[model samples]
Target chain A: MNTQVLSGKPLAALIQQRAQDEARVLENSGRHPVLAVVVATDDESTLWYVRSIERAAERLGIGCRIVDLGSEATEQVLASVLRDLSAEPSVNGIILQTPLPVGVKADSLVGLIAPEKDIDGANPLSLGRLAVGQHAFAPATAQAVVELLDHFDVPVAGRNVTVVGRSAVVGKPLALLLLERDATVTICHSKSGPLERHTQPADVVVVAAGRTGLLKGSHLSPETVVVDVGTNVLPDGSLVGDVDEASVTGVAAGLTPVPGGVGSVTTALLLLHTVEAARQQEPAQLAAAASAARI
Target chain B: MNTQVLSGKPLAALIQQRAQDEARVLENSGRHPVLAVVVATDDESTLWYVRSIERAAERLGIGCRIVDLGSEATEQVLASVLRDLSAEPSVNGIILQTPLPVGVKADSLVGLIAPEKDIDGANPLSLGRLAVGQHAFAPATAQAVVELLDHFDVPVAGRNVTVVGRSAVVGKPLALLLLERDATVTICHSKSGPLERHTQPADVVVVAAGRTGLLKGSHLSPETVVVDVGTNVLPDGSLVGDVDEASVTGVAAGLTPVPGGVGSVTTALLLLHTVEAARQQEPAQLAAAASAARI
Candidate 1:
């Protein structure tokens, strides 16, 4: 590949090391970083993700609990379960997996999570805090993007950064995070006229527009660090990204690979948040979940 | 001026016209946009601002009322007042002016205002809504930025826009608004490193950072539109903007003047929200308020 692949492994490892250090500090202080993840059903993907969290917590010496509510969980049951987790002294971070069965709206549950406990930063309150530059749980994936950029020694300060997409989950927060880093950021979405025109001038091009291969090299600067967050399954059962791999590699200087880039770092980032939440809540919570798990 | 200016005069007229159209529909439906502005011992400037709101409401055919509280207002007293206003049907929007006594926290009072009447969009919940792309009130000054941009036929879509500042009242919400309009938005604040570098590449630069002459000709592209939201008074008793006039008029394609730009549009937007809140509230509440006023 002509384009240098921006490896996330080392950056994710750095984040993991910090989490481990935090976990140790918590343990020394008789406080532990605790994360409670709720999965409503036995989807294969959810199982894998939950396992990743569980193992990461083990490796970092942090507390991670998996709560399975089953497929038929109602919103009331889910909220009640979340409330219990929120109130538990041992639980510092909470992660609710998506695809919460049919008829259960994810939007309604977003507001239900306490902003502090929202490790994934999906709560509207957390999001609002993010917008206002207040004390907030930075959305993990978006935070990871910045972390990865920093790890690569890419200077966001005074860079022209263009972000494609405005989904609350990734694009919007990512753009804000970049802005906070002093990069002049422009966010493009479906409504943005002439997407390529915006993309080509940026020093950093981050495509989280959801559509597979929506961005090509034609839209990028020569040495732009391209971060692609799209994970689309091609007809051939292959994973594709928002940036057309063939085109970007030849034209761009550095690019993040689809599967091993942002996606791989997500679970690790969650682990980091779990540890952060543990450290924050250690004074007030953590032991309660320990006892609850025992029961 | 070489720098671009987003003059608010044209934009204010446009937004007011829209607000007027909504007012007619609301009144025809037996609903009137009613605003309840409460203040504790208003300072001169504060009094002037209130008067401006009254005039704007009167001009728009929107109903307006005031709760001029004494300086010795307590949190309990204000909370009780807000609670009554929230319960009152006629009060569509609730605006609490400042000079808040030292002990009183402005944030604490937000919970007391009903979401429907939170026209100032000061409530954290409402601000959070804007962050998450949910339907909520955008702060007056921030919304005015977009309204002004749109009125001037600014091609916000796919443009690189930078907002300098992150104050809840202006910078933060303005960034969100730009993102909504499909602009690639980057936000730079005090902590933002090498912040001026980002401004040079921006198609549109919005300087809400209050420090006079914070933005200048060297920090901008000759084609950039400079919207200065700063309202500062100079030693010579002259109004000033964040951008140094000597530097900006020679660089930016367009720019907003300090006195006549963003500061002018904010009140009109507040009135618009009040009218909207009035239209949304039940008629029984306003009639009750009308009765109370008569007594």
Candidate 2:
């Protein structure tokens, strides 16, 4: 098998180095880049994800604040919290946790975010920005999808890339990013007819839909490279990807494991964007103000 | 050789009915939907397009004012004109001509139009609103492309739809609109490699590269329904679509022509959007206020 794993380790390392460089620049200024991570209705998965972000932020020398809310938090309550954070002078970025129990709409929660503080890009403003070629806090997971591929020296420009799924968080944004890089991208979803027809010829396949074995070997040719973005729980309570690992290992040229694939690179990307967001907030100016106050 | 023409004449007829119905609604409310057509250069194509819009508006009893500036109009001058139109009670919609002179940026021009007043869907705010599934004036051309496919009973839902092009006016916005329809959309552009690899299997293909005959019959399978958005002028002054009309006609099941396809549907769409924009504005409220003052 000519299969190669598309790893995010290298990109994470590069981003870490850049973060340290930026930290020094921020330290020279009086202020640091702060990301306020709001966690409401704490699920096990959310806890694990939050812990990782906390560790990553510490290692990167960036400020991280975890805001907790009750599971019964109303949309207004959550929105008010976000609005307060947005108004806070010290807070440079905001990341709101999703799946805020029953009755709360993700749509309404999204509009509450100040476009400038929305580092997670849950807001439509950010999505629209990317659509029009403006600078936006692209969904970290989506950015990681491409960053991982680029780190593996996978040539995306002019390649036939088929991305599965079209959520704002991944498939949709990734398509735009791929178009920006000049890749011919085709997006397929659960509704797409004859999935094999779209997958068989793909130079690169990114499967993000949370369905197990969605892309089997029969759907891919031996030359196809697969990046599975799904982190689905199997019947046995184990993690699985959208692409069937068994079929791809023997038939496809390359495959990324479900957990180690997109999931591994995602947290680091969140931190990377956070640090970049901080740096963009003018660390030098903050440092000067602090130094002046000290005198 | 089974290409059936996706005739816009029938589609235009259908849309004209909708436009006239909307016009009746506005006329009864004692408010005519008004569109302020702002033009700087008297480019032949621009003049022709403006005339078409004027004719459509006149037929619908919608008011249109041609804001003509000299060919050498500066960005500042044009922006100021748009700003005034945005504030004016009479102007319910605004259409800014593209290919702005040397000094004016299209992005800047779009920035000036109020989201409600932006009938052309040229503004960043409008584009952002569209991405998140909000009601915005989507670019008429992009909307027409999708509307044609949907109107023809071409099922976009769950189709492996590949769009080649990512221009702000056509490609990018169209991708977002298709995604909204639950179709798995992939966007390929000039940078996309082996473009045929993406096109060959697409259930639906939309080519809007602004280059003539970019998608050939050999590039697509017989089942692919092609919507050509290109309006390139041939060396001999003939207008052609991105797809070769003769080559794919027998092979592809459905194809749209260059001049008669998207172009014909576009002016009617521009008028439709203007009427919609006018309805959204409170022209009724204005007239009522004036009448109350007179009483």
Candidate 3:
């Protein structure tokens, strides 16, 4: 059986080009799209993700501001910094990074970020809006899976899809998004009875449970489209996805690799969301300026 | 094979009595809980629902004000009326009835209602909050299914539950609520392949597809707990649920009746939410008043 690899680099480059074009338009209109990423950790993987976002921002001609609060950053200080950025008119997008200081809850802190500037969807409110099918920014990883499928021309409508996660960030919102596209969705988590029972019958399977190699080829159909959203770091400092690639290499019709697939697309989508946020804020900014001038 | 009816009337009465107790406590504290319902059409079913809410409010000692915009109300007029009711300080709860006039959309207008008074979860924002596990009033009908299950001590955590329907008000929100209770949920809609394929494997099945008798006895596992949220009227001027009562009577272990099941529980939940909304609002009102007096 021959299998096709769904690489995300080409799609990410295509999206980055579009975002660059939109960023130029906004810049020419005197509205510079800026993304402020707040990192309160010293974790290597977290830093790597932050740097990737910076690189993607440069490609899109968007301004990237990385605020490193170090490992000792208190929740109070982080909240204040986020609130200040949210009120800053120049900051079009705000992202609160992971590996936050111990005892600091991410959602409660990120919820303080202005929704209009929340490009990464770290805020729970953004997830809620996505669930309700309202206009809100979706988490980059979840959106990446959908974008990858759409770019590959995979049929999602009326298909039985199993999403292996129940996270607020990925599994839950991704299920809602898939359901919006008319896909019959089943969400399975650790508590789910048998992963094989859900995955074997699904036409498409999306694994984002963060467990390394949790899904095996035996859990899939012969030609199922598998999109792995996991980025588990191995002990040898290598990255792996939730699906066992060796077992599923020939089993899946199309599969996304851990490093070159979802990761690349996620960074690109974040910049794209930044440009989109700028576009949404433009009209409101103009209206406010006009009102001020009149006053 | 003996079927037992999951009657919602007793549960509804019990909830109403609790709401009555809470309402009296608020009244004695010099704060009256008032629910303002906006009706934009003269549809028989819509009016019947409004009248039921009014009657329930009276029983609970809660004030009910129905704002009827009649049949010819435009979208602008309806929006204005709803906005007015939403801003009224005396009104503690706000609900907009369905079967709205032509060219008027329910969600866009109802979204203007303050989330504090959004008793029925008409707004997308309220639905979003519910999705995020935040404190927000959920749509009464969706909440009733869970309430019914909890009242009956039906186990949901780690159970395989199939939910039929995907309507924003019922199926979508109900699935989220059930998921919150740790139920591994499968959401099936019109696009889903077959009803039996999903229903046959579920430990619990919730049917809210609005089609009468959509779920059959053959679809059961003999002891599956069924919560039917459909309220379809029959030719004989009687109401029937989505489940065919006769077909499932001797097959299923537990089931809920049509008129006396989810409907009664829904009305009672609405009042319960109204009282909860009043409790949430009173603290803010008092704090604001105290600050003003101090100033």
lDDT of each: 0.79, 0.79, 0.87
Location of the lowest summed lDDT over 10 successive residues in candidate 2 chain A: A286-295
Supply candidate 3's per-residue lDDT for B254: 90
Deviation in angstroms for A23 in model 1? Answer: 3.7
Q: B284 in model 1: Cα distance from truth in Å? A: 11
Cα RMSD, each candidate: 5.6, 4.6, 3.0
Tens digits of lDDT, candidate 1, A1-295:
3678998887778888988887898788777778888889767766876888798888988787888889999999998888787767767888888879889877768787766789898887777666656667877888878887887888888777888888888887787677667676667788766777777767888888779879887777688789988878777867878888888887888898978888767778888887766666645345655565456
The residue-by-residue lDDT of candidate 2 on B1-92, one tens digit each, is 66889977788877877888898898897877888988888688778778888887888788889988868899888988987777777778
* TM-scores for every candidate against the unseen true structure: 0.78, 0.89, 0.92
Docking class of 1: acceptable
DockQ for the candidate 2 complex? 0.58
lDDT of 1 by residue, B92-146 (tens): 8888888787788777687577766888788777877887777788888888778
i-RMSD of all predictions: 3.1, 1.8, 1.9
